[model samples]
Target: MDPSTLFAVAPTFPMDDVRIRDRSRETMLRSPLTWLPLLGAGAMGFALDAGVAGFVLLLGATVALVSRYWKKRRPAVDAASLRELIGESNAAQDQELKRIIGSLESKGLPQYSLCLGRFLFLKQKIEKDVHRGQHFAVFAQEVEKGVDGICAEVCREITGIRAREERLGEILTSRQPTQLERLESARRESHAAILHAYTSLYQVHAEILGLGSDPTERETVEDPGELPGQRLQEILGGLRDEADMIARTHARIRRTIEECPPAVEAPRPEVVC
Candidate 1:
C-alpha cells in the first residue's frame, strides 16, 4: 500500500507551533507606538505640573526596564516541573505517557518548545481534565513527525487488511462464486460492512489533520466482492489470531473514532452490493 494514500491526514510540512501572541518582530513594530504614548505623556507633563512630567518619565523608565528583563530572562522549566504540571491522569495510561516522555528526554528532546510557542498548547492538552483518557503522545512531538509515525503504523495494518480481504474475496469467488445465492448475499454484506468501517476510519483520520472533509468518493472505495458468512469470522480470526494485524487495526480505528467530534458523521455509502 502506498504510504502517501494512507495518511493523507498529515500536513506536507512539519507544523510549526501555534502562535497565541505576537512574535518578537511584531513587538518591535510596536516600539514606535510605545514612543507615541510616551511622547503624549511627556507633552501633557510639560503642559501641566512638573511633577506630572517626572511621574511620566519614571513610568517610562520602569516599563523599559521590565521589558528588557523579560526579554533577557529564560523561562524556568524542567522534566520534574513538567510532570508536576501534567499533574496526573489515568494511572496506567498516564504512566505510559510519562514513560514515552522519559524515553524521548533520554534521546535529547525538550521538556517544552517555547521557541516554537506551543508549549502552553501542549501543556493544556496534557494537564486539563477535559482531555483525560485521550491520547496526547502526538502533541509530544512536532506535528509532522508524530503524524508520520502514526501513519506508518496504520499503513502497515491497512496493507494487511487489504491483503486478507482480497484473499478472502478470491477464495469465495473461485469456490462459491454465486451458486449459493443466500450465502453469497451474506458474504457480500459482511465484507461490505468491513469496508464501510474501514472507510469511516480512513476519512476520520484525514479529517483530524484538518484536510478538508474526507474527499473519498464512494465509488472509489474498495468493495469486498463476496466473503463466506461463517468463514468471515474465520478470516478475521485468522488475521487476528495468526498475528497482531487485526488488533492493531482495531486500535487505530478506535483511536480515530474516539478523537473525532460527535457531529462528524461516519462516511458510509448506501450501496446494496
Candidate 2:
C-alpha cells in the first residue's frame, strides 16, 4: 500500500534475481547517447577557450543532471522489461499451487484438507511479500521455506499413512479370528492410523507456518461433519481403497491357510488305532 515502497529500488538483491522490478543494467549502461552531449561539450570548450567555453561546460552539466533525474523518476524501457518478467514468475507460481490442489482433489487423497490449507497460506504470504516491496532476500527466504515445508509435510503424511495401512493389513491377514473380532480390530486400527496421520500433518502444517502446536492436539478447523459430503468423499475415498485392499488380502491369506493340509505322523497313529 505504500507508494514509496513500490517505487524504491532494492540493491541488496540484484534486479536479475528479482522476478519483478529489475531494470536491465546492461541496457542502461549501453546507452551511448547519455555521454555523447557531454563529450561534445568538452571538446568544444577546449577548441574555443573564449568565455563561451565556460557556458558550454555549464550547459552540458545541466543536461546530465536532468537526464539522471528523469531516468530515476520514470520507468525506463529496461525496467518495464524486468517488470514483465516478475509478472510471469508470479503467475507461474500461482498456477503451480492451483495444480497441486487439483491433483490432490482428483487423487482423492485423505489429507486433502490439510494440503489445500497449506497451499492457500503459502500463496497468500507470497503475494503479501511481493506487494509490500519487501527486501529480496527476505522474500526469497520466506518462499523457499514455504516450499520446503509443504514437501516435508506431504511426505510425512503419505509415508505414515502407507505404513499404518500396511500394518493393519498384516494384522487382518495373519491372525485367524471370529468375523466380529476381525471387524472390530480392523476398525480400531484404521481409526488410530487415520488420527495419527492427521496429527502428524497438523504439526507439520503449524511448523511451516511458524506456529507451535503439539502433534497430538486436535485442530480448530471445522469438524468433518460440517464439511460438504462431496468434499469428505474426496478426502476419504483413497483411504477406503487402502482399507479394502487390506481386507481383501487378509481374506485371501486366511482362505489359503484354511485349505492347506497338515502333516501326519503315520506310524505313531497306527499304535493308537
Candidate 3:
C-alpha cells in the first residue's frame, strides 16, 4: 500500500469536525451583525428610560451585551478549553496503546514487539513531518488514527488467539473432541488475522515513509495505475473480506457443533461383588 493510499484509508477523528464547529461559532459570535439585535434592544431601553423600570431594563441590556462581548472576544478561554479536551482524549488513547503494548511485551510476543517498534518509528516520522507545515497536521492525524486502529486490531486478534489457546489447553484433557477442534480452528483463524494485520501495517509504514512533507510535492507525485482513493477502497474491501471470512468460520464451527451428537461418557464397569 502506498503511503498516500494508507492515508486515504485512515480513520477520521471527530476533532476536525469539532474544530470546524468551534470556528464557525466563533466567527458568528465575533460578527457585529450578530449583536445588532442586542444593540437595538439596548437602544430602545435607553430611549424609554424615564423611570425605574426603564433604568432596570437598560442596566440589564447593558450587562447582557458586555457579558456576550467579553465571551466572544475571549479566544484564549475557548481555545484553551478545546485544547484541554483534545489533549485529554489523546492522552487517554496513548495510555491505552501503551498498556496494550506492555501486556503483549510481558507475554513475549515477538510479532507484536516488532510491530510496536515499527509503529513507534513511524509515529516519530509522522510527528517530524507534521512539524513542517499546518497542512500536514490533518494528514498526520489521519495516519495516526490508521496506525492506532492497526495496533488495536492486532492486539484484539492476538488476545483472542491467546484465549483460544488457553481454552484448547483446558479442553485437551476432556473427551469433547468437537469443542477442542473448534477452539483450535478459531485460534488458527485468529493467527491468520494477525498476520494480515501485520502485513497491512508494514505496507502502510513503507508508504508513509515515502510521503513528502510538502503538500505541493505530494500533489505532483501520482501513480497512474491506481488512484489513492481507489487504493483505499481496495484496502477497506480487503478488511471487510477478512472479517467476513472470520465470521463464516465461526458460523461454520457453530453449525458443525449443533449438528454433532453430544459426547457421552463411557459407563464404568460394574464393581466386583
For candidate 1, write residues 166-199 as lDDT tens digits: 4444344444333234333433443343444344
Q: Per-residue lDDT tens digits of candidate 3, residues 1-273? A: 112111112232556656645755665566665576667766776677647777677667766776786677566555555445545555565555566566667777667656655554554454344334443343555555555565545544555455445545446656778777766676666667656655664554444444433445556665656544444434444543443444455455446545655545567899999
- Per-residue lDDT of model 2, residues 176-204, tens digit only: 44533544554455445445434433433
lDDT comparison, 2 vs 3, better candidate: 3
For every candidate, C-alpha RMSD to the true structure in Å: 22.1, 17.1, 9.5
- Candidate 1 residue 26 Cα shift, in angstroms, is 7.0
Over 4 Å off in model 3, which ranges? 1-12, 16-90, 104-145, 213-273
- 173 in model 2: Cα distance from truth in Å? 2.0
**Steric overlap count per candidate:** 0, 1, 1
Runs of candidate 2 with Cα error greater than 4 angstroms are 1-90, 133-140, 143-171, 175-273
- The best-first sequence of candidates by lDDT reads 3, 2, 1
Worst 10 residues of 1 by lDDT: 111-120
TM-score for each model:
0.25, 0.32, 0.49
Residue 154's lDDT in candidate 3: 52
What's the C-alpha lDDT at position 17 in model 1?
22
Off by over 4 Å in 1: 1-5, 8-63, 72-152, 174-273
